[model samples]
Target: MKLLERILKYQIVTSLCVLTLGAVLFYFSVDYLIDREVNKELMRSKAKVSWQLRHINELPVYILQLGDSLQLDQVRYPGQMALVERKLFNEFENEYQPYRQLIFYERVEGAWYRVTISKLLAQRQQLLEAVVMTVTFIVALLLISLLLLNSWLSRRLWRPFYKTLRALDSYQVEKHEVLTFPKQHTVEFEQLNQSVTHFTDRLAATYQNLKEFTENASHEIQTPLAVILSKIEGLFQDESLKESQLVALSEISEAANRLAKLNQALLLLTKIENRQFLAGTEPISLVPIINRKLRDLEDLIEQRGITVKTAIEPTGPVMHPALAEVLVNNLLTNAIRYNVNGGTIDIALNAGKLVVRNTGAPIHIDPELMFERFRKEGTHSASLGLGLALAKTICQVNGQTLTYETDGPWHILTVTW
Candidate 1:
């Protein structure tokens, strides 16, 4: 859940608990007050009835207050004075209702009589019921008002936060663009925006410096490497050089070429990992690239006596054309380099997928480990062990899956987009 939603949830739960508890307490409080008042009225009536009984001629018919009835019963002996409450049947309403009665013994004209003042509680019960409904209604209105107000406040108050989040979402480091924000009223949001601006500024500067350094270093290193290879070629053509010296020169030339290839491969891998190449919106078919690469490596395939099979479609994945060529080249070359003589190579390309399976010696360990740079299954002196690693890096940067598996003597490399 979003931060605003979580806050609102906690607020709603807290309000409900407090409102419910308050309502219960207030309801009981009101009921208690009403009961106290009813008891007071009954006591006042008891005093009046006592006076009337003492002077029997002053009042005789009825003396209870409104909604109350007075009753007197003659008895041989007075037992006790007490107050009691019970449910009584009302003749007018034809229903059972609550009543509070004050019972006391009195002596009148040399005879013992019990006096009872009974008060009807139907009105009090109605008042309490009304109170409960009113409290419930008020609480509901309060909750609804709180919810609406909280939602409005949360959106209004946290607007700056969401705005900052959106800015970060669309941020691209390759663009080297620094983030900027309007002034925020909230202190925390303003601080957060300022922090983000500073962070992006630092990141852009660092990326630019690194990119410049990589390009400059590669350019600088390539110049000397070219000179060394050119000099080694000159030494190869020297007529006076002995056979041993020529052999040594050939070895040096080969090592120099390998070093140059390694440098270029590492540079390409670094650039790909840095997202220097951005994929296009549309998927570019790999069939043409696959066919072209196969033609370029046809002579090698024919020399190795390896049979090649291809099942290709026009569909492909979204990627930069240059990176796509490198990816396919590495996969295909790696297959050929490791394949057994007179073996078969199967290539399948469909919508969103490409699979390359080459017959080779069975591998005992995991195929994924081969994706690591300089990790090779067996000693292939000509192999730099970087082909699979470079291909894996390209797929990762382009949001594709490159998986490897071995079945019997066939080594499979699958790329899924």
Candidate 2:
């Protein structure tokens, strides 16, 4: 959930709990006050009844019918005075209603009697209604205030934070730009802004230093490799050199050439990862590129006695044209390099995807492991093992997916956008 949503959820829950508790306490308090008033009225009625019983000769039964219930019962002895609350049946309403009773013993002309005075506790409903109204009013106010607070927070308080986030989202290390923000009133937001600015500043500096170092190292290493290869080539032309020495020199030349290629491949991989090549917005057609690569590699395919089949459409993914060429070349070469004699290579290109399935010796390990650079199937093989790694990197940087799967002798490499 969003941060504001989480906060709102907890606030509402706590407010409701508090409101419920307050309503409960308010209900009981109102009920208590109503009972107190009712009990007082019952006591007054008991006093009048006691006085009337003492003057029984002048008091008439009809005078006691003024809303209060009065009862008298002659007893052998006067018992203790008592007060109680109970629900009593009312004949007029044909239902039970709440009443408070005050009972006292009275002696009238030497005859003992018990007098009970009852009063209805009618304010209980009003207490309930009052509590309900108060709770509802509180709840309504809380809801309105919370909504207003949330709106104000989102628009005003969180504005600078979101702006800082947008700046960070589009940040690019290659641009070597340091991030700075306008002053913020909120301390936490200011701290966040400062931290982000510092982080981006450090990131840009580090990336620039690394880029320069990589360029310098690649240049420095390439000159020596070229010299070594050229010197070995010159030694090969010397007829005075022994056969064993020439063989050793040839091996050294091959190793040097492979090392140079590996270095270039690694540099290219690093550049792709560093976002040096950005893809175009529109997808470019792979038909022409695929046809061109096949034509160029026709001799290699024929030499290996490999049969090539293609089911292609004029469709491809959005990517840099140079990277597209490299991606296709690697997939095709990888298929050819690993194929058995007279093996079959199947190429299919559709609107959204490209599939290259080649018949090779069944690999015992997972096909996904081949994407790791320098991971080779054979220990003594001449292959540099960077081809699939480079292809995978290109697809990744260009927002495409490259997957490897195997079925018996057919190894499938798929790229999807």
Candidate 3:
């Protein structure tokens, strides 16, 4: 989830909990306050009745009326004041109404008299309900407003972090381009940008040093390798060499050739890794490349008596031309080199994909390990085993996928983007 969404979720949940608890407390608080006001009114009525008893010297006629709101009764003993809630019947309304009742004793003319006062609470209850609803609505409106305002502010506050993320996504080490971070006011975001800039600087320095080293080492090794091959060729031409000596010389020659090939392959892989091909600047068609390579290998195919089938479609994909050649060459060579006598080589090309299938015995090694450098099956002593690995690296450099699978006696290699 996005950071803003998570923060808002937690805040909203906490606010809702507090509001629920506050609502319960609010209801009871209003109930108590309203009851206190009713009781005060009852005390005032009792005081007025006592004043009347002291002056008038007789029971008031108003107290004798049935259904009157107040009632007075003469008693022999003093009684304390008490308040209660009661359900009383109303003759006019013909229903039970809740009332707040107050009963107290007042001394008048040397005798104690009980006086009772009651007030209907049905109207007051309606008023309290309305007040509660209004308060709740106001609180809900405030909460909603708070959420919206907070969301907007959070998006604005986090804008710098998002900008930094986009920059990081687009950054590529091979490009060697200097990174420039936008100014950020927040301390943490500023620190993050600084750290990323420092890290990229270090990575670029390391890549430059590695590229230099690979090129220098490959060049230095090739010169001595050329000299060794020359001397080995001279030794092969000598007439006085014995049969046992000839075999050893041949083996030495073969080893030198293999070493030369390995050096070239490693250099090519390093170049691909360094993005030195510049294939991105131009578009290359695969149909012509495939046809030319096949033509070049026609003699080898005929020697093995292999049947070649092709279903080529016109495809124009932008990639390194030399790298593209290497990719196709490796795949075709692997297919031909491993095929049985009179085996079939099937090649297909379409938009954004290629598939090469060849008839061969099932590979003993796991198919998943086939792309690892120097991974070989059985006793293919002449094979260097870097072909598939180099091909996979080229595909990855061009933002493509390469996969291998075996079905029965047919080995399949697929390249797709």
Tens-place lDDT digits, model 2, residues 1-417: 977677777877787788778778887787778777776777766667767777763345554434558788889898889998889997766888877778898888888888887766555666668777887888779777976787677668788978997998888888898999998989999999999889999998889888888889899999999999889889899999998998899889888998999899988888888887765788899999999999999999999999999999999999999999999999998899899889999999998999999998888788899999888886535688899999999988788999999998899999999
Q: Arrange candidates by TM-score, descending.
A: 2, 1, 3
Which residue ranges in model 2 land beyond 4 Å of their true spot? 40-67, 77-86, 89-95
Query: Which residue pairs in model 1 clash with each other?
Result: none
| TM-score for each candidate, following the candidate numbering | 0.85, 0.89, 0.79
| Model number with the top lDDT | 1
Better of 1 and 3 by lDDT: 1
Q: Is 1 or 3 the stronger prediction by TM-score?
A: 1
Candidate 3 stretches greater than 4 Å from native: 18-128, 279-283, 364-366
Give the per-residue lDDT digits (tens) of candidate 1, residues 1-417: 988889999999999999999999999999999999999989989899888889863555456666688888899988877878899888888988889999998888899888888999988999999999999999999999999999998899988899899999999999999999999888899999999999999999999999998999899989999999999988888899999999899899899899889889888888988899976788898999999999999999999999999999998899899998999999999999999999999999998899999999988778899999999888887888899999999899888999999888889999999
Could you give candidate 3's per-residue lDDT for residues 119-157 as a string of tens digits?
777877897999799879977998899899989999999
Q: Indicate the worst ten consecutive residues by lDDT in candidate 1.
A: 57-66
Model 1 residue 187 lDDT? Answer: 89
Q: Would you give me the overall lDDT of model 2?
A: 0.85
